[model samples]
Target: MGAATTRATRGRRGLPWLVVGLWVVLLAVAAPFAARLGDVQRDRATDYLPASADSTQVAELQDRLPGGETTELVLVYHRADGLTAADRATAAGQVAAVAHRHTLTGTPRGVPSADGTTLVYPVGSNEPGTDEKKRDAFVADVRRLAHGEGGLTVRAGGPAALATDASGVYASLGGPLLYTTVGVVAVLLVLIYRSPLLWLVPLTVAGLSDFLARAAAYGLNQAFGTTVSGQSAGIMTILVFGAGTDYALLLVARYREELRRHELPHDAMRAALRGCGPAVLASSGTVAAGLLCLLAADLNSSRGMGPLGTVGVLCALAAMLTLLPALLVLLGRRVFWPLVPAHGSTPVARRSLFAAMGSSAGRRPLTVLATGAALLGALALGTLSLPGTLKQLDTFVDRPDSVTAMETVAAAYPERSAQPIEVLTPAARADAALTAVRDTRGVADARRGRTGGGWTEITVTASAPPQSAAETATIEALRHRLPGSHVGGPSAQQLDLRDTDARDRTVVVPLVLLSVLLILAALLRSLVAPLVLVAAVVAVWGAALGLGGLVFGPLFGFHGTDPGLALLSFVFLVALGVDYGIFLMHRMREESLRGSEPAEAALTALRTTGGVIASAGLVLAATFAVLTNMGLVPLVELGFVIAAGVLLDTFLVRTYLVTSASVALGRRVWWPGRLSRAPSAAPRRVPEPVA
Candidate 1:
C-alpha cells in the first residue's frame, strides 16, 4: 500500500518536469526560424490590397515585365516667392546630373507651375527592378540629389518614394515595439502583484511565450505561404504579452488561494489549474476563434492577422498554463516572499474595492443596468462626428517628404491631379484603350507610357485633385468603358481599399459574432448568457467608436479615419472585451452550481473575480495603447479605440452592468442549464476574501 502511494506521488511530480523539458526542446528548434521572421515582412500597398483589385493585377503584371516594376517619382523644386535665375539653373544642372548618373526611360522634362513657384520633374527608372532594398537605395540617392539650398526647397515625392518611407517606418518598428511592450508588461505586472519577486515570473514567462509565437508564425509562413506584414507581426507580439500575462494573473491569483487550502505545493497547483483552466481555455479559445474569423476578410492584411494573432494567443496560453505552473511549483511558496501564503493559513479579511462596488450594484440592479445602457448609447452617437475616409497622403501621423511634395503639387495644381492613374490593357487593344481613356470626362490627359509582356500601359491624369470625387468618377468611367483593362495607381488603390473594407465588414463581422456565440454557449451552457455577453460587447464597441469620433478630429487632429479601423477594432474589442465577460460569468455560474442564491452568487462572483479582471483589462489596454505611438495614422486610431473600449468594458460594462444584469435576471441568466431549474438553496459557505 505504501509503495503504491509513493509511485503515484512520483508520477505526479514527474509530469511537470516532463512538460518543461518538451517546451525547452521546442524553443531550441524554433529559435533559428523565429529570428528570420522580420526579414520576410512585406509592407507594400500590394501586400494589403484585395487579391482581385485592379491595382493588384497591375502590380503583378508590372513585376513580370522585362525591367520589372518601374520606380516613379515627382521631383518638386519650390520657392516661396519665385525661382531666381540661379534656382532655375541649379534645377537644370541637377536634372542633367541625375540623368547622367543613372539610367532613365527618357530625357526628363520640367513642367513649370502656372504660379511659377514650383518646377515639377517627372522621373521614371527601372533600375531598381523588383527588389525593395534596391528601390529604397535608388530613392535615397535621388533624395540626396534633390535637396534644398538657400531659399529653394527640392523634394522627392511619388509612389516609389512613399513606399520607401513606409518601409523605413516598418523596419524601425521591430526593436522599439518589442522592447516597449516588454517594459510595459513588466511594469504592470509589478504593480498588480505588488510583490518584488512574483511579477518577474509572469513577465519572464510572457517573454518566452512571445518568442515561441514568433517561431510558430514563421513556420506557418514557410509551410503555407502565409502573408506577413509588420503591422500584423507587431500586433501579434502585443497579444502575446498582453493576453499571456492576463492568463498568468488569473492562474497566480487562483494558485495563491489554493496554497492556503492544500498542504503541498504540487497539490495546490493542481487545484489551481483545475479551478481556472477552463475559464482561461475558454477565454483564449474565444479570442482565437474571433481572430480566425478574419480569414473570411478579403483584405490581405486582415486575413494574415487571423493566423498570426491566433498563434500569439495560443502560444501565450500554452506557456502560461504549462511553464508557469512548473515554475510556481518548483519555486514553492517562498516566491511570494514578504506576503507568502503559508500552509493551513486563511487569507486576511479586508474590504476590497470590488466588494464595495458589488454591494452598491446589488442594491439597485435595474437602475444601474439602465443608466449604464443609456451612457453607452450616448457615447455611440459620437460616430456621426468621425471624419470622412482618410486620404493616402494623410495616412501618416507625421507628414513625410512625399506627402509634403504631394501637398505642394495639389495646392499649385488645384484643377488637375498630380499623380497619374495607370491603365493596363491587352497590347492588341492598346489604341482603343488609349482613345477611350482620352475621351473619359474627367481625364486631363492620357498618354501611352510602356508596352511589353503582351500588355500596354496608359497613364491618365485626372482633371480633379487626387482621390477627390471627380477623380474617383473618372476612374469609374475608365473602368466601365474599357473591357479587359485595369485602372490602377495610388488613387485607384485607395478607392479599392475603401470598397474592400465595406465588403470585409459585411462578411467578417457576422462570422465573428457567430463564432464567439457558439464558443460562449458551449462554455457557459446557456443561451441567454451568451446573448447578454455579446450584446454588452457590441454596445461597448459602439460607444468606443463614438468616443473616437468625438476626439479624433478635434482633440487629436487626425484628419480622416482609416478604412479598416472599424472592422479591426471591433474584432479585437469583441474578442478581448468578451474575455472579461467569460471570466465573470464563468465564476457566476460556478457559484450558482454550488447552490448559492442568484443575488448572492452574482455579488460573490464580482467580489472574487473583479480585481483580477480589472488587472487583466488594464494590461491589455496598456499594451494596445502602445500602437498610438507608432507613425501610421491607422495604427494610432486602432490603438486608441481598442484601449478605450477595453477600459470601458472593464470598469463600466463588465463590472457594474454585467454584474447588475446577472443579479436582476437571477437563475434565468442561466436558462436551460440545470442550475436554473434547481430550487433556491443555501450555499455551503461564504468564501473568505483573498488579499
Candidate 2:
C-alpha cells in the first residue's frame, strides 16, 4: 500500500511538470512572433473604414495613380494679430523652399484667410505615396523646417499630418498601456490573495497569455492581411489581462476551498476544476462569441477587433485553465503560505457580506428588483445628454499640433474650407464631373487636379468648416450630383465612419445578444434564466452609456462622443456583464440541482460566489479604467463606459438586482429544467459544501 501511494504521488507530480514543459516550448516558439506584433499594426484612417465605403474606394484608387496615394498638407502660418508683409514673405519663402525640396503636385498655393492674420499654404505630393512610414517622415521633416519663430505660428495640419500624429499616439501606447495594465492587475491580485507567492502565479500566467495572444494576432495578420490597428491591439492586450485575471481569481478561490476539504494537492486541484471550470468556460465562451459577432461588421477595425478580442480571451482562458492550475498544484498547499487552508479543516463559520446582502434582497425581492431597475433607467436617460458625433480634431484628449493648427485655421477662416474634398471620376467623365462639382451648392472652389490610370482626381473646396453639418450636406449633394464619380477625402471619411458605425450597431447588437442568449441557454438549460441575464446586461449597458453622457461632456468636458463608442461599448458591456451573471447563476443552478429550495439556492449561490465575483469585477473594471488615462478620447470614453458598466453589473445588477429577480421568480427562473418543478418528498440528501 505504501508503494502504491508513492507511485500515485509520483504520477501527480509528473503532470504539472509536463504542463510547464509544454508552456515553455510554446513561449520559445511564440516569442519572436509576439515581438513583431507592433510592426504590423496599421493606424491609417482608411484602416478603420468599411470595405465598400466611397472613401475606401478612393483610397484604393489613389494608390494606383502615378505617384500613388497623395500626401496632402496645409501649412498654416498665423499670428493672433494681422500678418505683416515680412510674415507673408516668410510664409511664401518657406512654401517656395518646400516646393524646391520635394516633387510637389503643384506650386504651394497660399490662400489668405479672411481675417488676414493667417495664411494657409496647401501642399501636396505623391512622393510618399501609400507608404505610411514615408508619409510620416515627410510630415515630420516639414514640421521641423516650418517651425514658428517670433510672433508667427507655423504648424503642419491636414489629413496627412493628422494621421501621422494619431499614429504616433497609437504607437506610443504599447509600452505605457501594457505596464499600467500589468501593474493594475498585479496590485489587485496581491491584495486579493494576501500571499506574496500565490498572486504571482496567476499574474505570471496572464503575462504568458498576453505574449501568446500577441503572437497569435501577428499570425492572423500574416495569414489573412488582417487590419491590426493600434486601437484593436491595445484592446486585445486589455482583454488578455482583464479577462485572464478574472478567470485566475475564480480558479484560485475555488482551489482554496477545495484545498480545505481534500488531502492531496492533486485531488484538491481536480475538485477545484470541477467546481468552477464550467462557469469559467461559459463566461469565456460568451465573451468570445459576442466579440466574434463583429465578423458581421462592415468596418475594418471593428471586424478585426472581433478576432483579436477572441484570441485574447481564448489565450487567457487557456493559460488560466492550464498553467495556473499546474503552477498552483506544483507549488502545493504552501503557496498559500500564511493563509494556507489545512486539509479537512472546518473552522468557525459566519455569514459573509454577500450573504447578508442576499438575505436582505430575498426578504423583499420585488422591491429590490424594481428599485434597481428604476435606478438603471434613470441613469440610461443620461444618454440624451451625450454630445454629437466627434470630429477628427477632437479625437485626442490632449491636442496635438495638427489639432492646434486646425483650430487656428478654423478661427481665422470660418467661411472657407481649409481642406478640400477629393472626388474621383472616370477619365472619360472628367469634364462632366468637374462641371457638376463646381455647380454644387456649397462649392467654394472646384479644380481638376490629377488624372491617371483611368481616373480623374477633382479637388472641391466646401464653403463651411470641416465635419460641420453644412459640409456633410455639401458632400452628399456632390455625391448625388456627380454621377459615376466617388466623393471622398477627410470629411468624407468621417461621414463614412459615423454612418458605418450606426449600421454596424444595428446588425452586431442583435447578433451579440442572440449568441450570448444561446450560449447561456445551452450552458444552464433554462430559457427564462438566460433571458433574465441578457435583459440585465442590456440595462447595464444603457445605464453605463448614460453615465458616460453625464461625465464625458459635463464633468470631463469632452467635445463629442466617438462614433464607434456605442457599438464597441455595447458589445463589451453586454458580454462581460453576463460573465458575472454566469458565475452566480451557475452556482444557483448547482444548489437547485442538489434539491435545495429555489430561494434558498439563490442566497447560497450568492454567499458562495459573490466575494470572488466582486474581486473579478473590480479587477476587470480597474484594468479597463487604465485606458481612461490614455491620451485618446475614444480610448478614454470606451474605458469609462466599460468600466462603469462593469461596476454597475457587479455591485448592483449581479449583487442586488439579479439576486432579487432570481429569488422572486423562484423555480420559474429555471423553467423547463427538472429543478423548476416542485420538489419531491423523499430522503433529503444534503449537498456537500464546495469546500
Candidate 3:
C-alpha cells in the first residue's frame, strides 16, 4: 500500500503553477460577493429572528401602548440622608420635563422603589424608526445630562447599550488576540524550524486556507441562506490555524524522516506524502464530519457553526495537499536551512522523554492504566454538581448593560419592568382562565389583551428574571395548573431552548461516535480496534467533562451549567481526542505487521508515534489556548478543557490505555478477517540503516 501511494505521488513532479493561478482567480471573483452576503445579513436582524412571530400583536398594540422602541435608562438617585417626599417629587418632575423637551416619547414613567432610594424612568424613543445609533445617542445624551446634576448616579443600560458595551469589549480584546496568535505561531515556528523562510510557510498556507474558507462560507450562506457573524469569524480563524498547522507538521515531519532514509529529495517528498497523507486525510475527515454533525442542532447559531468550521477544516486539508506541497516542492531542501540534514538511522533508537515514557507504560501497562483511570474518575466527580441554566446575562462578568438594565427595571417598577410570560388559554374559557392565572403562584400581575376575534393574549409578569430556573418552574406549574391554556413566553422560550439543546446532545453524541468508529474501522479494517479506540475516547470525554466541571464550578462560581457545554464538550473530546488514538493504533498495527510481538509492537509504536502526538498536541493546545483571551467565558472554558483534553489524550490515553489494550488483545486485535497476516516470530538479522 505504501509503495502504491509512493508510485501515485511519483507520477506527478512538476510545479503546479496553474493550480495556484486558479486559486487566485477564484479568490478574486468570490471576495466581493462574500462581502455583499455579510452586508445583507447585517442590515436585517429580523431576517435572523423574524418579528413576524409577533406581527399581528405588534400592529394591534401600536396605537394604545407606549412605543416599544424606547431604551429604558435606570437613574438611581441616592442621598446620604433619607430622601424627603419633596426630593422624590422634584426629581420626578425634573426627569419628566427633560424627557418632554428632548422629544423622548411620552412622560417619564417614574416608579420609586419601596425604600425610596432609587427612581426608575421607563422612557421611550420619540423617533418612529428603530435605528440602533439613534437609540445609542439618546442614551448618551441622557447620561450626559444626568451626571452630577441631582447627586444622582445614572447607569443607562438596555439591549442596545449592552450590545454597544459588548462590541467595545470585543474590539479591545480582539486586536491583541489576533496579534498575539499570529506572533506566537510565527515565533514558535521560527524557533522550532530555526529558519525564517520555513517559518512563513504554515502562516502563508493558513492565510490562504482562511481566505478560501471565508469565500466558501459566503457561497454556502448565499446558497443555503445562512447568516454568519463576527463571532463565527473568530472561530473560523482558530480552526484554520490549528488544523492547518497540524497537517503541515505531519507532512513536514514525515518529509524530513523520508529524506533521512537515503531517498532522493523528490522521492523523499513523495514518500512523505504517501506515508503521512492518508493519516492526515483521515484525521481531517473525522474533524470535518464531527463539525458537520452540528447541523443537527436546533439553534441557528449552532447550525451556522457546523458548516463554518467544516469549511475551515476542508480548506486546511486542501491547502495541505495542494498549496503546501507545491510550496515545499518549490523550496525543496531550502525549507530546512541551517540544520544539518537528518539521516533516518532507526528513528526511534535515540533516547528521549517520549521513549522513556513509552518504555515505562509498556512495562507496567496495568499500573499505568489503573492510575490514569483513577485520576480521570476523580475528576469526573465534579460533573455531579453541574448546573443546567442558560442565562445569557451570566455571560457578562459584572455590570454589563443588559444585566444592569434588568436590575434597574426590577428596582424601578417590579411589576412592569419584568418580562412577561404569556399564558394562552382556550378561547372558550379565555376569561375564566385569565382569572385563574392572575391567582397562580409567583404571578405579580396579569393582563388580558384581545387581539380581535377570539384570540386573547394573557401576559403574566413574574417576579424573577425570565431565564431563571424558578421562572421556568413557574411557567411549567402554570401549564400544569392551567392545563387548558397554551403557555408561551420568554420562559417558554427558555424551556424550548433547554429541551432542544438536550435533544441535540443526545442525538449528536451517538452520531459523532458512530462516524468516528466507522472511519476508524475502515482505516484499520479491525472491528475490535475501532471499538476499543471508541471506548478509550469515551473515557477521555467523561474525564474532560468532570475536570471542566471542577474548574468552572469551583473557580468561576459557574453554578449553572451553560446548556451548550455538554454538546461542545462531546464534539471536542470525540473529534480531537480520537486523533491521538488513531496515530497510536495505526503505528501499532504497522509495527505488529513488521514481525514484532504485540507487546513489543505496542512499545515500538508508542516510542515512534509518541513524539509526534505530543508535538501535535502542544501545537494544537497552544492554538486553542488563545481562545482564553477572547473575553468570552464559554470560549475560555472550552479552550481550557480542549487543551487539557488533548494533553491528556497524548500523555495518558494514547500512550497507556491504547498500548495496554493492544497488548492485552494480542493477535486478536485484528479479529474478524485479519487485514494482514501477522509476521512469523522468527529472529532475523537487522539490515544496515538507510543513509
TM-score of each predicted structure versus truth = 0.98, 0.97, 0.84
lDDT of 2 by residue, 35-57 (tens): 99988888887889976899888
Candidate 2 residue pairs in backbone clash: none
TM-score of 2: 0.97
Task: Give stretches of model 3 more than 4 Å off.
Answer: 1-14, 33-107, 124-151, 158-177, 227-231, 261-266, 340-349, 387-390, 408-418, 422-436, 448-459, 478-492, 675-679, 682-691
Residue-wise lDDT of candidate 3 within 1-691, one digit each (tens)?
A: 9999877666555445655667688779867765553343322112222222222223233322344333434455544344567667666766765675577645666666776666655555545345545655666666665543455445555444554555444444435655666776777677667776887987888877877787788888878966575455566667788778878877887777777775456677778888878888888888888888887775555667788888888988898887887777667776778763555545434465666776777777777778878887887787776655746555554446446656656655554435556665556787888888877777778887443344555767776666666777777778778764566543465466566667778888888888898898888889898888888877877787787777776786664665666787678678877777777788777766667777777777777677667777777777777876665566667677777777777778887778877766777777763634555575232322111
Error of 3 at 375 (Å): 1.5
Best of the two (1, 2) by TM-score = 1
Query: Measured by TM-score, how close is model 3 to the native structure?
Result: 0.84
RMSD of each: 1.4, 1.9, 5.3
Question: Residue 229 of model 3: what lDDT?
Answer: 55
Off by over 4 Å in 1: 7-11
